[model samples]
Target: MRSGNIFLKRNEVVFVVILSALLLVVFPMALDSFRLNLVGKYLTYAFVALGLVLCWGNAGILSLGQGIFFGLGGYGMAMFLKLEASSPEHTAIQSTPGIPDFMDWNQITELPAFWLPFHSLTLTIVAILVVPAVFAWIIGVAMFKRRVGGVYFAIITQAIAAILTILIVGQQGYTGGINGITDLRTLKGWDIRTDFAKEVLYFVNVALLLGCLLLAQFVRRSKYGRILVAIRDKEDRVRFSGYDVSNFKIFIFCFASVLAAIGGAMFTLQVGFMSPSFVGIVPSIEMVIYCAVGGRLSLFGAVYGTLFVNYAKTIFSESFPELWLFAMGALFIGVVMAFPNGLAGLWQAYAQPWFDRIGQRGAPRPISPAPISPTAAPAERRT
Candidate 1:
């Protein structure tokens, strides 16, 4: 039995590797720059979705504030980019250059002091990872220690994201106000507008996505992972088992936050900007929807969910922008009703047979089941 399980696990790993290679290598070659860029965006989201799978899918925690972490990471990178772009002599410049933009229209002269630290790439990257984790740690401790979960947890997270967006937007001088940060020139001395830099960013995003997926898998397979599953299945029972459930919950929460930050950082690097619009309550809900549509229980689901949904969004919003939300709502409903396991779940159910057939065609079949002999039946039963 153990041997059979090991074989199955190996097969699954091989399949995942093959799929990842195709996404990272094959698709970029075939697709145009615009399409590849869009796909890259989905891939970045996939990283965050994978993180959600660890926290919410396997661990049974419903967090809706992943966008906040994402925004923090994005803003971190944006701050650095903006600072790097800014002239050394003057403290502030036009938000979008030339016409003075909105802030210039409002007579703003200098950038806020907080924005100074972001001038350094090293500081920006560090802040991108640390800020989100810190926020998650604080919020997780406060809420989990007080025993918040389920709908309450989700609501609080959603509110937190909303509040953060408002704060960023209201802090005009510091955060670039409602306009946020835009018109980024370059990153680390490389021209962002160049195809070379774009391609580099694309590959970087892919690498980060792969890293995040592997890290989540590691956590999921660890001993603590099993405890998380136990806690998810029965929190009271897990507590009775002498584990500090709150600490475990907090740990997963923080893990998810860090993953979201990575995703966000990759996203801003690709798009070359950040805005409050990117991290509001709606985006937070959308992140949840991505996880739900993909497969709340599976990592593949989260990634596929982000990719598939984003693809659909691009198609629908372009063709029928007015009805995009309605289309999404209908699609969500359809998935909820017809594919309860999510798209990944559906793929698992149906695709495995085809994969097994291909594997079996090339590989030797296991030894046929030994026929039961009448004389040996009693001995076998006794053994």
Candidate 2:
């Protein structure tokens, strides 16, 4: 099959089907509400990994500030939730009953102008989608147009992440400081904290993830995607071919940012909070590791990689908190050194071939007619 025509190849389709079944059926069935909710949170990170597969893996843009966009989206939703939770009835004892609790605690008497729109669910949803794209566009225009990339681009992005973290933490009154915009209780009058709500949100998260995956697959199989690969391999050649490479880079970067933002929003909904801890250098870099471990080039691998790494972290950190960092560092090193293409690469290299061989061996074979024409003719004559 032609390359683009086979975006969802037979094997890939099977993999996706099985993964969907596991995530949508098996996991929900097996895990308790708490564990399942945690899985939902991890799946949010998978969103960022999927974006990295496009921006970093395909286009060769390594952003170390994706958490910024994620935080933006999360904060957007959290703002609305905070507003709902801080209604006049809920915070009647506070000095500013209509404002968020953090604002009141910090001695603020009124809500900020920016926080006004968040009171409207429609506006909040729009902000969740638009804010990150706009921010990403600004960054992309500044960097890509100037031909800034490689380690320098990564450094700049990391700096942006750091700056955002500081701003969020420093503005204690406005942003809730280190505590972040927490105690998010409701979404348009629906109590998000309820177990039933969590289950519904998990399904919503999965559906959105699947939609994003399909979109990513479409982009990956497009002529635009090929151009991205070309730019990654040889920027000058693509530029020489009359393509405005920066435009493509900008668009993909913004696209990736939007995806991260959506994930962040979902994270807030599922986890019930948004914090600056998720908007800093460490989390941003960790997000990259997820893509790396999943096979940066593989979208499906990104999801599994995120789940596997997070699952390991949860188990190991609970048992050996002090050694968690060491384990993570070792895991990163092992992945880079031994399986550069990650779990997906490993499967493609070793497991897939073995599976194919096994399939071939186990396939039903056609049986030849016994004793040929002479024996059949004698039997017919006797009859």
Q: Model 2, range 97-153, lDDT digits (tens) per residue?
A: 989999999999988999999989899889999999999999999999999999999
Model 2 residue 134 CA deviation in Å = 0.7
**lDDT of candidate 2?**
0.93
Candidate 1 residue-pair clash tally: 0
In model 2, the runs with Cα more than 4 Å from the true position are: 1-7, 358-383
Q: Rate residue 127 of model 1 by lDDT.
A: 88
lDDT of 2 at 284: 96
Question: Which ten residues in a row are the worst by lDDT in model 1?
Answer: 1-10
| Residue-wise C-alpha lDDT for candidate 1, range 193-286, written one tens digit per residue | 6666777788888887877776676677778888888999999999998999999999999989988888888888788778898788877777
Quick one: best TM-score, which candidate?
2
Q: List the candidates' TM-scores in order.
A: 0.88, 0.93
User: What TM-score number comes out for model 2?
Assistant: 0.93
